[model samples]
Every structure is written in structure tokens, then in C-alpha cells.
Target: MKTKFSFLTLLFIVSSFVIAQDIQELKIDSKVNDVTVFLDGAQVTRKKTVDVPTGITNIVFVNLSPYIDSKSIQVKVKGKVMVQSVSQQRNYMNNQPDLAEAEKLHAEIFELRKQLKLAQTYLTITRKELDFLNDNRIISGRNNELSITNLKETSAFYGERLKALKLKEIKQEDDINQLEKKIQQLENQRNQLSDNRGFPTGEIVIKIESKTNSKSEFELSYLVTNAGWFPSYDIRAKNISEPVEILYKANVHQDTKVDWENVKIRFSSSDPNVSGVMPSLNPYYISYNYRPSNYGRIISEVSGFIYDNKGEPLPGASVSVEGTTIGTVADINGHYSLMLPAGSNRLKISFIGYSSKTVDANQPLINIALNESAQELGEVSFRDVEATSISDALQGRIAGLDISRSRNKKNIADKESIAVPFVQTENQTTVEFEISVPYSLKSDKKTYAVEMVDYSLPANYQYFCIPKVDKDAFLLANITDWSKYNFLEGEANIFFEETYIGKTILDVRNAGDTLQVSLGRDKNVVVQRELLKDKTSRQFIGTKKEVSRAWEINVKNNKSQKISMVILDQVPVSKNEEIEIEIKDLSGAKMNNDTGELKWEFELNPAKEKTFNLNYLVKYPKSRTLYIE
Candidate 1:
């Protein structure tokens, strides 16, 4: 019985060894098939096909983004294969393709450095010769006697040599400076290219079991954090009678180190990085207030350039409001402008190879210079645990969740006229726009403009002027039913009458039923405000002082067409009980008593003008002085 048990144990051991050896490991490269970019992140899908052996096999997909979210990984296999497990890991052994331009720049910089060293050597030699000549001249003059003619000849020779050496020294110095400048420029270019490189590439390994030798296709997808898109718009109006043309665009950017070449791309309004958990309301309790400090000055928008310590522009640098996700990437010229959220006081600026900086956001223009990091970034590690097994019956259903394929296609009679061919998909929490054509995007962090769609909506054009603040009249376009357009708050470039006006912020988040877009200032529709000296008076009663003031505003429609205009004026609202204000005349204007704002709407024809007068009186105690204008 002992001998039989030993034989069974030996057989079992041999069987286990063979089974372990049967699992073959295969390394394959997968192509990026589709990418769905969100506002804060992106979902990348890769697909590959390989012949499966009639046993357990492990397929490893290589050259993926290092910033991938391991928990969001999903793998699906199609064929007679059962996916047993999936895992992600960082492969430090793999070498990514170097940037060709960057490599060229490196070589060029090396040559320039050699030239600079040679020039510096020449300058050093020239200076040494000058010093030696000076020493020899002093020694000869003091230690030896010579004729006048000889002395004159010796002095001439010495002076000529000194001048020649000095000129040579200056020339060499200039050459060295020029070479150093060239090297610096090349180094800057190379640094920009190698910003996010020198890191390990990511890999996804799937262990599957197959019943027979067959061919199978695999789809692997994961969420990456260093990719996103932002919206921008162009508002164009030809005239007051024509409909406004709104062109929507997306600025897509990525630094994932994986180039998306001719892949299907989609833009989603959802932000996967933000927590999706439903927020619960806590109990509201009233509390007594103590001292309330005045809030600092609120900044509406901030714009500036990002630079390195060497004063070179750092394109693709990130600029964001501290403690908030509101951010933007610097453009090719290193210029970035972001609208500040309410109560945002600080801005955080960062780049790949530079130390991040935080600056106060109180100023409209905040430029930051970042220093190079002294230490290398830590290695990114990923979890290697088994992924949730996807059943063969639900593989197709699960794949559909990442991207919702549209079945209904819109018929386009004139495809050539479409700026961008795309289909819009509405999801539960977000809207997606799938581009019909394939797009190729590089792994660089620079933003690429992707034109999405355009809409022509009927707009009511009105000229608005607050002469008390600004003398120029701004043209406003009010578009109703704007919610259907899926517009986000972003900067818009305004064009009126086929001329580029200026940029304005499209604050869709704070809009009502009608979206009012400012088309910048129109100098043709002029406005001016002046004080009426005749109606201004001051008097003093027994213990009270009273002052009366009047102002007149004129609006002119200098354009050839008639236009509607809205004029705004304001009266001072008294905050103290001892101070009293009364409106004497408003010239048929609607007044808001609480805010002390007056509004007048009227129509003016070509070369026509309209005038409105505002008169008010203020009464205050004689002991206190109140300034009014």
C-alpha cells in the first residue's frame, strides 16, 4: 500500500508540472482602435488578434500609457477562449521611440557646444598672449638699453600685436556667445519633447484558456488621466437681421505617450475623474455669527504666459485654480487664459520636468516661472490583481458600455458643406459627440483644435451701453432655446459684419432661458455721458445737508441700419439710515429701487440719436460728509 501511494503522488506531481509548463506566454502589440475623451480624462481602447493554442495562454499587450487607471481596465476575448484573469504592470525594459526632432536637436546642440568650447579656447589663448606681451615689454624697457629708433620700432610692434590680440579676443567672445545662444534654443526644444519621457511603458496581460487551437481577437481598454478636452466657440453675426452662426470646437490634448493614429475619437462631456457618488444633504443648523472679515477682491479671469527659469516659454504647461479642477493647458506660444471660479484665490502651475508653483490669482495677468526639478519622478506602479472575469455571453454587452454605437444614421445631402462629420449621442449623465472620420493625434501635450459642429439660430441683436462705466456700445445677441446646443462655459471669439471683434466669455452656467452673448464693442454705435451743470445744486437745512445732481447720456446709431439699444444708469443706494436718496427724474426709464439701477430700451435709425437724463437728490447729516458724483 505504501508503494502504491508513492507512485500516485509522483504522478500527481508530474501532472501539475506539465500543466504549469503548458501555459504559453505571448507578447503582442495592439492598435488603438478608439478613444473617448472626457473633460478630465480619456478612455483608450486597443484591439489585437492572435492565434490561440489548444491550451492556457497568456497574452501581453505592450506599449500603453503609464497613467492608466488599473481598476478601470476591461478585457474581452472573442472565440472559444475563457478569460481566466487580467492584470496590468509597468514594463521598464521597453524603450519608447525617441522624438526625431528632439534627437536632431540634441546632436545639433552637441556640435554647437564643441564650437563654443573651441571659441572659448581661442579667447583664452588670445588673452594669455596679450599678458605675455605686456610682461616682456616691461622687462625689456627696464632691463635693457636701446636707441631711440629701436625703442620706437619696438613700441610700434608691441602696440600692433596688442591691438591684433584684443580684436581676436573680441571676435572669439562674440562667436562663443552666438554658439551658446544656439545651444540654448536647441536644448529648450529637446527639453519640451522629452518632458514626459524616460518613464516605463504600461502593459496589460490576459491569461485565457482555450479548448481548441483557434484564432481569437482581444479588446483591452483603460482610463488614462493625462488626457482631456475643453470646449471653445465662435459666435458670428453678419447683421442684426440675420441669424447668428455659432461654431463649436474642442481643444483636445494628451500626454499619454501613446500616439493615437487614425483612430475613431469621441468627445464626452462627462468627467470620469470626478466622484460620481451621489452627495447627501446633511441637517441644516443655524448658528450665531462672529466677526466677518471682508472677502478679498474677486478676479473674473486670468491670462498669462508660462516660462522656465531660463525665460523660455514652456508650452503644454498646466495652469489650474488651486483646490479646484478648473484648469487649462498652455498653447503652442505658452499663452493660457482661464476664467476664474468664484472665491478662487490661488493658481497652481506645473509642467512635467519642473517644480510646480503656486501664485496668487488676484491679478488678471499672472505669469509664473518654474525651476527644474532636482530629483527624478517616482516610478508609477500598477496593480496586478486578477480583473473581473467577463462571461462570453456578456462580452458584447459589456463592450458596448464603453462606447454606445449609434444605429440611426442621419442622411446628409451635402456632405461637402459640413465642417465636421459627427453624430451626437445622449447618455444618462452626459452627451457624446462621435466623429465620423478617423483622427491622428500625437502623444505631445499640446492642444489640437477639433471642430465639432455649427448651429445657426435666430438671435435678437441689441446694442447695450452703460455709459457710466464704458463709453463703447457692445452688441448683444440673445439666443433662446440654447440648452439644446450643449454649450459649456468657455471663451468665444466674436465676429460681426464679417470682421473679427474680440473674445468674450460665454458663461452658459449662469444663463437664464435666453443666452446672451456679447459681440464685443461697436465703435459705430457711440455713446457719451456728461454731467448737467445747470441742474446740479447743494443746500443746507438746520441739521441736514442736501445735494442734487443730473446727468445726460446720448446714444447714436452711426451705422446705416436701424438698431435697438439698451441704456443703463444707476443712482446711489443709501446704506445708513441718516442718508436718504430720492429720484427726481428718470426720463421714462424703469427703476429698480433696491439696486438703484435704471434701464431704458429704445430704437434708433441710421444717423439718428437719442438722449436720456437721470436726476437724483441725496440728503445727509451736516456732521458727516458723503461724496457723490
Candidate 2:
């Protein structure tokens, strides 16, 4: 019986040892192979190949971004292995790598502090020595009688010693001041660098079960924050006779704390952060509206970007309405929006190291640049204000503004040489551009411009002018079938006739079948509007008033070729039944009765000019005052 018990014990021990050996923990390194960057976040795909033994195993992937969403974790294993479960956890032990420049600056600041301390100590000691010399300066007359030569020598020694100590004290103080300034500069630099570092990493652990020992390939993917892309464009037109060439590009940025080296990039217009489920409509209940009323009309909101003199975004800048408490701060992207009270027409902008500026708030979009200030101000604290949503701020708020994406085109003659580096794919609700070449994107917050594609489309160009509003003529290009090119609303750099003109916004979201793009002001086309003083008159007839006004507008085409031009002018419409307005002469112009706007279209040859006349008469009660311009 004793021998049988010993054999069973030995068998049990061997089986337990084999089971423990089969289940092993393996740490594997993975490389970021592909990245799909969205408008708000990015999806990272990593791959690795490894050999595994039979049985259960835990594969650990380390050094990932701590901002990764755990629920988005996905693991796939190819070969004879079956993925049992995948999990992720924060790895505080493995922090992000320290920035080399920041570390060097820190060392330099430490050394400078030590030198400043020494200089301060030396200055204090020198001052003490000067005091000691002054206290003993009376020794010559008080203690004993001395020869004239001895008295002169002692006086000279004291004068020379005091002067030397004073100079030394001045030198030490200067040195200390310089060291402090140097330390401050270095600290600022270090602070900027340190902002991008010290984030803890993450680790993903996958449990796998394999039937037989074999080589396995694994793919892991997850969504990470602090990464996104925005679109920008370049619109070029060599001349009015040719088509407009549009260059589409994207500004990609990421701060995932992991460098994406030689990885394939795909820009997706879809925002995975937004919910995919369709919204359901609830039953509506009717109710009476009761609200307080203000006297003047109030602008709902105003939104725009705040930039520094160098065109860089000034985040955390303060923007407030003049003479009111309504205000908000810029976001991390330098975007701000404020709700204006009644009759607020000016905006006050301020920053710590930049000069404050006050600008007119008459427009919906107000972008301002603040210059750097010589004197630094104390830190300003901002309240945590909830920003208005993009949809809420844009819907029916900004007239004629739309959002979409677009592609660019090179010159028509160089169409063969133009190589598109991306393939466009359309999904149900979004579009994606898959880049062909691999990209190496570092873990920095700076933007990388990625050129997508170029396009040259047929356009109808015409010159448009509103002489009453602006004397300069603006060139407009009407592009038919613009919807085929997926376009997003963004800032566009405009170039006409081989010269860089300026910048404009390309908004196609609210466009119809035809898209009209402004090519900026053309100085060659001169326009002048004059009011005829002899035709202006006002008279009263027994509590009734009659006013007559006449204006003349002249347009001259100075270009070497014939051009099409459209001129626009407006007349005031009566708001009260007691007032009446009549147009005597519009110079054969088309008029909109509802808006009282006149439009004239014509073609002019080089060095040719055209003139138009507008005459109007207004009749109103003489008791009420009326203003017209």
C-alpha cells in the first residue's frame, strides 16, 4: 500500500510541472504599421510575428499611448492560435522618453542658479568690507599723532580700496542679473518641451490558446486621442481664359507619445468619436412662448480664431465684448466664440505677453492678431466656460458658409506629370484618402502638410464689382458640377495671373449645382461712384417731405483682353406705409423688387469704360426725421 501511494504522488507532481511550463508569459514588441487619422482622433494598427509554444500563452505589448481607448482594443492572431481574451492597462512604470533638449536646458539652468548664488554672496561680502573700511577710517586722527607723509599714504589706501570694492560690487550685481535672465529663458524653453513629455505608457495583454507549436502573426488596433487632421487648399488661376487649378492638402498632427515610423497613413473624414446610431424623434408637445424682450437686436454668437503676429495660434487668449461682461477664452486650437448682448459692436482681445486689441464685431467671423508686448503681465485666470458646438454655431447662423472636402489640380498642360499620391474611397457617410507612400511622423505637436491630389476644372470667370461698397473689382470663378469633388470649407490661398493675390474661404456645403469662388481683388479694373450734387434736393409740402437723389458709377477695364463684368447696386426700401420710394432711372439694369437691388452685366474691351446712372425719389411725412446715404 505504501509503494502504490508513492507512485501516484510522483505522477501527480510530473503532470503539474508540465502544465505550468505550457502556460508561459511572453513580451513581444510591435511596430506601428498603419494609421488612419480622422478629424478628431486616430486609429493605430500594429503588427508583430512571433513563434509560440502549444497551450495557453499571454502576449504582452508595451509602450503604447496612454490615451488609447480600452474599448477599441482589437487583437487578431493568424496561424493555429485562438485569441481567448484581450485586455489593456496603464503602465505607469514605463513613462514616455524625456526630451533631450528639455533635459539639457534643465542642467544649464541648475548651473546658472549656482553661479548667480555665488555672485550674490560675493556682492554681500564686498558691501560688508566697505562698511568695515568706513568704520576704521577715523583711526588717523583719534588714536595717535602721525607724520604728514604717513597720513597721505593712509588716506590714499582707503580711497583706492573703497573704489575697488564699489566696482567689484557693481560687476557682481550685473553678473547676477544676467544669470537670472538666462535662467528664466531656459526655464521657459524647458517648460514648453516638458509639456510634451512625462505621459505614462500603456500595455495590452492578449491571452491566446494554441493546439500545436507554430509561428503566429498578430495584428492589434486601437483608437488614440490627441491626434487629428484638418484640410487646407491652394487655388491658382493663371488667367481668366484658363481653368482654375486647385491643390488639396491636409495638415496632420499627432501627440500620441509614440513615433509612427515608416507607416502607411489614411486620412478619413469620418469622426469615430461621434456616435453612429441614428437619432430618434420624440413626440412634440405644443406650448405658449413667454419671454422677456430687449430693445435692440442682439447677435446670437461670434466665432473665429485668435493668432499672434507670427500667424501662430494663441491658445487661452481672452476675448470679451467691449463694455460688457460677455466673454470667452480661445480653445487649444485658438478658436473662440462669444454670445453678444444687445448692441455690442466691439470685441476686446488680450493675452499675457501680447498687446490687447479692440476690434469691430459687426461681422460673424472676427479674426484678430495681437502683437507681442515688451512688458509681461500677471497670469490671468479664466473661468471654465462651455464652448458652443460647431453644428449649433454654424447651422443657419453663418450665411453662405458650408463645410466639405476637396481635391486639387495642377496646370492642364502638366496633367501628365501630376501624380496623385492617394486613392479616394467613399463610404456611406464619409470619404477617405489612402496615401500610397509610407510616412514617418514623429510624436511632436507640429503639423505636417500632406498633399493629396490636384485638379483642373473648367470654370467661367467674370469680374464682379459693388461700387457703393468697394471700389475694387473681384474676380469670380463659377465651377459647375463641383459636388463631384468632395470639398470641405477651409481657408484657401488664391493666386491669379501667376501672382499671389491673397486668401479666401472655400465654402461649398451650402452651394448649389454651381460653385462660385472669389479670386480676390483686381486692381487693374478701376471703378468709381459719384453722387451728383446738382440732382440732390429736399422740399416740404404741408407736413409732407420729398427728397430726390442721383448717383453715377463708372467702370474701366485696363486689362489687355476683353472681360465680362457684373455690377451690383442697391436702393433703400420703405419700412413704413407712410413713406414711399420710386426709381426714376436704373440705366436699363435688372432690379429685384423685394430687395430693391439692381444688377448690370456687360462686356468691355481693353482700355474701355462704361457708365450707369441711378435716380431715386423718396416721399415721407415731414414731422418724422429720415436719414439716407
Candidate 3:
């Protein structure tokens, strides 16, 4: 029950990508038994409570059943809690503090431990530097101990430089108590700016049988924090086999004596009659926030990332982005990396306002903050990016996005139907998607032609569907009951780069007589053109982005063979960096310049739309004009 490891700097202000016309699976998490779930797997309610009412959005954190077993039912996400705790001023161990000065010393020692004489000298100097940083960083061996491997990289670089100079002397003693709270906010803005009307929010009617307040039933729910008082409720235990024992009783105003720890559980604060006992009430609010407990004041902010109207990436939002900076952190889920002025361009996101966004500097990703502004009077929670999500319904009617499992299969969606590129050799070329049938469901070489047995596919990875090829069986079993078949419309011209990584399909069953199909809604989508076109706009050709070579495509009958496409392109190595590729198409008809491979015969003519002819090279740095979507 130690659980006192904080460096609090969490800000999170990225929410604006919510399009789930249907088919969900977007993964999200926040455990330790507390709760922050968001799976994108499908159907979910219990958002607990979320409301900022206004500006900024760009959320994402999907893991929904990555085909299960990503480590036993693994779908972990929620990565942008920014600055959790980082305090120290044993003299700012030489100043360098960050993590919002460790979440402003975990929100100032949990609000000066209820004013224990303004924090009994800050819990006696964080219990004497948590007992000499837990005895030289957790019992000798400091920095989480363990060494001996030719000086384990010089004892883990001087044990992480003595835990980063003892967390920059606990963030220079919380930036000298935030420069004494910026000198008491410049002496309250030079005295007399009285707006002390503060108290506004209020709502408390939860009774869950009073959580055993003389009755029974020990389940609960009631949340809201900071700006209000009365320990926030957080009793979490979502169906854990069994084991739900809670018996907290509070009453410690007879004169202080508290102490409570976390991580599993522990309590101690006796006083029920001075002779001892009365300080273990940790009712549960766990935002811990260890604010710049000691050192704080780093600087930098221009923030970005906020989308959700089907653009995704909005984990937590409550930003400022104005004049420069004020507060915020969460973004991994909503995508943000702000520190400002590394090149500073522009940013704004405003909350409690309902209509205040501004973003710039070439879209660092704000996916969809198109709200317009209106509804935001007050309490009515749960709007965690309700614009529309599910990865924005396969972005533009499924041009390509395979990572399925979301028909309520419980999350792991985003870019569903996509299977057309696996072309193994014979000079690789592509233009796939085949399944036409309709001659009375064809099947009969007269003499009762029957014999389609061939199994072995527990799970080889590639599982999207529509592989009914059998121009007399090139390896697909012939046709038994692998789901009747049908799914071939117009395989986009050629633009395959669904992020390959060892890809595995295994030539349609056994390649001797194939017949296996999966996806059917008559899909084929198609829409992709410039795979490098002529080259212009400042043309340096590329500073990087021309690697390409990972091809695969199939279609036994409507034919269009030879595949090795990776074409992708991008340049600019610095000045905001850029580098992406997998190219090699020599000249549409054939050539494998070592491995950027590309061979063709191209034909799959089901609906229409086709074009092929490739070349590669890009390294620009000077002239600019990049407009992408």
C-alpha cells in the first residue's frame, strides 16, 4: 500500500472526433481500479462523467480486442495524462523542473493536507524528502535499484543522474512555491480586484443506500472535483469475480491525526477519543495530481491536437493556448506535443466557453473541432466527444482500413474492409478484389464434380475477406461453404500502404483451387491518384521517402496480376521533419530496382477505374506547397 509515486503534470485537452454512425471499437483505459474506460469495441455506457462544455477536441485511444491476446484480452490505451507529479527544492537540485513541476507538487500536497497548519512545514518537508528519496532512491541501488553489467551503463547514467537531481530538487521546491504564487498574483493584481463570489457548482444527492450508512448495498457513483469540496467518490470494482468490501467511516475534526496510502489499500489515523484512531478516510478521488509539490516553472506552450466529429485524438481538454500558455497536458489519445516556440505557429482551444478554437502551423492535427458553439449552460455531463466517431466511419466509406472486430464484437475497429495486396512474385503488380459469380452459382464439370476439402487456417493473420478466385483453382479449395462468396466492385487504382508489418495470407488456402470470401456489402470503394505525378512545386524530388517494397494482391478470374506496390512518397528531413515511403514501380509494366519491386499485367475490371505507371524520387527542402488529406 505504498502507492505514493507522483510527478503530476496532466493537462489533456484534445477531444473532437466522434463519428460512430455504427461499428465501434476505439479502445481506451485508465485503471488501478479507478475507471476511465473507452474501448471503441462497441456499446459502452458508464462514461462516469465528462464535461468541458466547450472548445477543443481531437480524441483517439483505440485497442478494442486487437484480435484478443495482445497479452490476454489486452486493449490498453489512454496515454496523455501529462505531468503527474514532480516536486523537489532541496534547492531545485540546480533547476530544470518539468512535468508541470510534478503536477504542481501534486496539487500542492493534496491541498495542504486540509491545512494542517498550512501543511506542517509541508508534511515535514515531504517526510524529509520521502526519507532521503526513499533511502537513496528506494533502498540503495537508487533509481529503482539493480546494477552490475560492466557498470550497467555507468550505473544507469549515475542512476538517472540521481533521479534527475532528485527531481530537480522537487521542481525547485515547486518553483519556490510558484514564485509565491506569482507573488500572490501580483498582490492580487495590485490589490482590490475582488471577485470573491467563487462558489457556484453544486449537486449531491447520491445515496446508493448511503453506502452502508446504516443500510446495506455498497455500490456508488458521484463525481466532480477541485472547484468544489466534499471528498469525491470513486469506489470502482466493475464485476471482479467477488471481493467488494468497503467500510469507511469519517469523523476527524476533534483535532487532526490523518494518514492513508494507496495501491490495493491501507489506512491509519486513530483518534476516536484522542487516545488514538481516526485518520483513514481515503473515500477515493484518486486524481492525486501531485502538483509541482516543490519545483515548477519551465515554460513553452502552443499546443495542438483536438478532433472528434470523426477525426479522433481528444483525451482530455481544458486548454488555454492564448497569448501563450496557462495549463493542459493529455494528448497521446488526442495527439499533441506542444512546448511552444520550437517554431511556434498558432493555437487556441478554450473551454467553459463553447466556441473558441484557433489552431495553425500546418495542422498538427485538429481533426474536427467544427462544433459552432451553443449548448454549454452547466452540469449535464457526458459529452466526451459526442460529435461522431468509430474512426469517422472508415474515413470516406472504407477506401481502405483493416483492423476489424466491431459489430459489437467489442472494440478494435477503425478502417475495417481492406484486403487487396499480397502478390508474392512473378514480378509483382496489383489492382485487386474479385468475386463475380452468377451462373446459377456456377459449379459443375458435369460428372457430378464434387470434392472441395482442404483445411488449415487457425489464424495466419490476414482476415478481411473477398478472395473467391478459381480461374480453375490457383489455390482456394474450389468452393465449399466458406460463406458462398461475393465482394468485388472497383479496387481503387493502386495505393496500398496499410502499414505493412510482415503481412501473412498464404496464397488463398492452398492455391490449387481457391474459394474463400468474407466481406460483402458490395464494397470496393476506389479513390487514389497522384502516386508521384510528374513532380513540381519547388521540386527537389525528396530528401527522404522513397523506400517502397511490400506487395500482395490476388484475383484468379477478372485478372490483373504481378504486384509489389509501396509507392508512397514524402520529403523534407528537417524544419518540421517528414519521411515516408515504400516505392518502386520503375515504369508501371515491371522492374524491381533491388526490392522497391513492381511487376504488372493489371486487369481486374469489375466496375472500372484504373491507371498505372509509376516512378519515384523526393527530397525537397526549400520551395513548399504541401496540401494533403
Candidate 4:
């Protein structure tokens, strides 16, 4: 009885093991590869179901993307199943040509080679027979009488057999060539199919335990690399009086070795490559310093380089001061220098194969590049200045306009535009726009623009001029509530009254509530300044000299509409107390005494003319020579 019971127990255990030994395949393909991407990696997930018995079982999930990080794989099972082990591996053989098809090609090639061997064997045998006939001297035999007729009959018999043998050999050669070519063609087709196998498909194996007979759903996730996105923008303003429309957009791209195929997407403005360590703060200190003052005035010396459009130096280029005979030619390195008169602010540069360029000499170092002129001449020039760009052109023009990224998590946009949703999120360290709609992007470097935000803001237009530096007047558009819109610094094309004026950089990073942009210069208002040489005089008293100067300015409004304008000029400021200066006449102009700046603001009617005068006197010691401009 004891032996029978023990045997029965062992038999029961065996039966249970046999029943639980059932292995099921849960083929799960990666369904989501377009998850929010980090700087270092991307997020991906997959799901499937596997039936489990009331015991331990192995579940194999196939067709996973090869780009998945094997080490990052995590498996979760529902329905009272405990995952024992989760692993990932690649199977290139599975993605190769079908085994039966490959075998068929191999068989055909083998058969052809066998046939070729037979043909070669037959050819050797025929050649040997022909050699035997040649050596046997068939024209006559040792013990046989020879006759001309018998010889002819014997020769005819051997010749006919030789011709048949040669024909057979030729046919075999042709057959071999055809067979080889056919085999080669089949092999090439197989090779082409292999090449199109695409990314190596991988599989995930999961060992799980179930307490009772049950079915479980498996959720798998892994991280991948080579995916991210960038932002672009479009800004439009119909008229100077109307509000500006700003359309924010995003350009996303990915090459994770898998097709997303309408998978929902979430974008994050984060870089996973950044360290997650907490930052430490240290104490700060400040100090002050003092120095002696130098009363000497700095001479205005301008230096610059002349380069071609390709950034190569034009050694023989000519650089000259505008309206003056003073000039210099560039050296071998395209460097030149000239002492500028106090009132002169422009320089002209010219090269043989390039168009001449005029640049402001206000800065100490002025670098000018010339563009190659077209061969054709006498083309009509356009009067209206076209805007350089119609949208965001402020890129690289301002500081602190960079959008930051996070290492983990993406904020999804709440607002949807035409079924494409946009999510905006902000922090002290980063700002992000999360798009929920699926965006298709390939590994190719082509750019795709997606609209993110649209904004309309009020703006005011004004005409301003600084005649002391530039003679032309510029149109300025002042916008308040600029801070309300989260704008990045970029290039903007300006248009006024339905006409494109020019392009200007829109830098809202440093602007607080109000932002001002300069449209191109206006030509309707004309301004001129003339020196009154007849009223100028100089005299010497003892060892001191007194110099007196006078100037007149004329401004005219040529437009049909009345306009207000601001005119700016300046009198020389003295760094030395020994130099005595006095303002004699200002013609009721506003003066900033500390800066010696003069300003005039007034409205002029259509086709109206206005005049103003400025007079000043400078007295200094005659013993020391003075430079006046």
C-alpha cells in the first residue's frame, strides 16, 4: 500500500507538470515610438496578451523594434501573474530571406553545377576520342589494302562523327552559360530581397508564474535614442496700424528604426543628457575701486577690413572717407586705417569684381564685405525696400532667448488647433510646448514647420531721427504688452502701409513691457545742415584764442500728410575745465546740458519748410594747438 501511494503521488505530480508545460506565444509589436524625446534617449511602449496555466510558463513576445535599449526594458503583467525574468535580444535570421526560398535557389544552383560537371565530362570524352582517331592514322591500317574509294568512305565516316561530336560540345557550352546566367539572376534577386529586410527585428522573452489557470496582459516599455524636436515661428503684420500676428511652430524628427504609424506623441523641452545631481550655492561678495581721471580727448580713428562675399580678403580693395580726399588701399590682409573728421561718419569700399559698399564709421572697428556684382548692367532698380523676412528673424540677435529642455517627462499642450493640440508649460529653468497630435518626421534633415501659437498685439508707429549720426529718418514701431507673449528673439520683416519697408531683428528677451523696432529709413522728410562760414571767426587775445562757429539746418515735409519729426544734434563736450565753451543761439531747442545734446520736435504741414540755427563759441589757450570739428 505504501509503495502504491508513493507511486500515485509521483504520477499526479508528473501529470500536473505536463499540463503546465504549455508555452504560448504573445507577439507584441512596438505600438508607440513617438513618445516625448529627451536629449539622450526616447520613450517607447508595447502591449500584448499571453494565456497562462496554473503554473510557471514562458511567454515570448516578438517583433519589437531593434532600436530598443535592451537594458532599459521593463515588463509588467496583469491578472495574477508574476514576471520572473524579462530580456531582449535580436534575431537577424528571422528577418532574412525565407528558408524555403533560399533553399530553392541553392538547389537550382547545385543542379546547374551538376549539369555543368556532366557537360565537362562529356566534352573531355569527345576530345579524347578525337585524339585517338588522330593517332590511329585511319587513312590506312597495317594489314589492309588501301584504295582511293575505300579511303574516301572511311574519311567520310570519321568526318561525320566528328561534326556531330563538335555540335554536341557547342550545345553543352551554350546550355552551361544559360544555366549559370539564370542562377546568377536568381541569386541577385535573393540578395536584393535581403537588402530590403530593413532594421533587425528583436524579441522579448518573459518568464512568469501564475498561481491558477489564467490569462494575463503584458505591458512592455523601453527607451531609445535618435529622436527630438525643435521650434520655429512665423510673424505677420498686415499694416502699421494693425496688430502683429505671431504663429509659433515646432519641427520634430526621429529615426528610432520603427514606424510610429499614427501613434500619439508628447514633446518635452528637456535634455536627459544633463546630470541630475543637485546644485550647490555659495556665498557672494562685492567690492568697489577708484581711479584717476584723464582729461585728454580721444581722436576718432577708424580701422576695418575688406572681404569678398566668400570671406576672402580683397587685398587691393580701396577704402576711402566719404566726401573727403583722404583714402587708403587695403594691405595683403585687407586691413586699412584712416583718421576720420569729427563730422564725417561714412566710409566707401570698392573692389574690381565686387559692388561698392558704404558703411558707418561710428564704430572703431568696421568690417565690410562686398558682394560680387552681376555681369549684366543697366537693370532697373527697385524703389521699395523689400522685407528680408516675414516671420521670426530674431534668432541669435538676443541673449536669454534660448528654450531649455528637461531630462524626463513632457508637458502636453491643452489647446488644439485644427485637431493638432498644443501644450505650453513653463518653469524657471525651461519652457516647453508639448504637442499631442502625431507628427510624422523622418531621419532625413528636411525641416517641417508646425503652428504652435497665434498672437495679435497693438502697436504704435513713430518717426525718429538722430541727424548727428545718420541723416536718414527711421520709422519705429513701439509695442507694449510684449511681455504677455512668450516670444523668442528672432528676425522680423517690417511692413508699413501695405508696403514692405525692410527687415529688423525682434529682440524681446531684454525688453520689458515695451519693444521698439526700426523699420527702414523714410525718404519723405528731407534734412540738410550747412556751415555758416561767413559768420565764423577766430581771434587771439594774449596767449588765448577764441573761435566762433555757426550752423544752419533746413527740414522739409514733402508728403501729402502732415507729420511730426524729431531732429537731434550735439555740441562738443569738453573733458577739460580749462576749455571754455558757450552756447550763443539755440533757436528754442531743448538741450541736455550734461550731454550737450540738442533736440527739436514739431509738426509740419504738407509741403512745409522749417529752419533752425545753432551757434557756439570755444576759447582755449593759444600756446597749445587745438583740434576743432
Clashes of each: 0, 13, 130, 15
- Model 2 Cα lDDT, one tens digit per residue, 442-516: 775455556677789899999999999899999999999887677765557899998999767676665799999
**lDDT of each residue in 54-100, candidate 3, tens digit only:** 22221222211111111111111122211111111111122233445
User: What lDDT does candidate 3 reach at residue 406?
Assistant: 23
Give the candidate order by descending lDDT: 1, 2, 4, 3
The TM-score values for the models, in the order shown, are: 0.79, 0.69, 0.19, 0.47
Arranged by TM-score, best first: 1, 2, 4, 3
Per-residue lDDT of model 1, residues 401-464, tens digit only: 2323343332212121224577776665567778787757788766766667778899999999
Identify the superior model by lDDT, candidate 1 or candidate 2. Answer: 1
lDDT of 1: 0.79
Give the local distance difference test score of model 3: 0.27
Better of 1 and 2 by TM-score: 1
lDDT by candidate, in order shown: 0.79, 0.76, 0.27, 0.63
The positional error of residue 128 in candidate 1, measured at the CA in angstroms, is 7.7
Off by over 4 Å in 2: 1-23, 96-108, 118-178, 185-197, 275-420
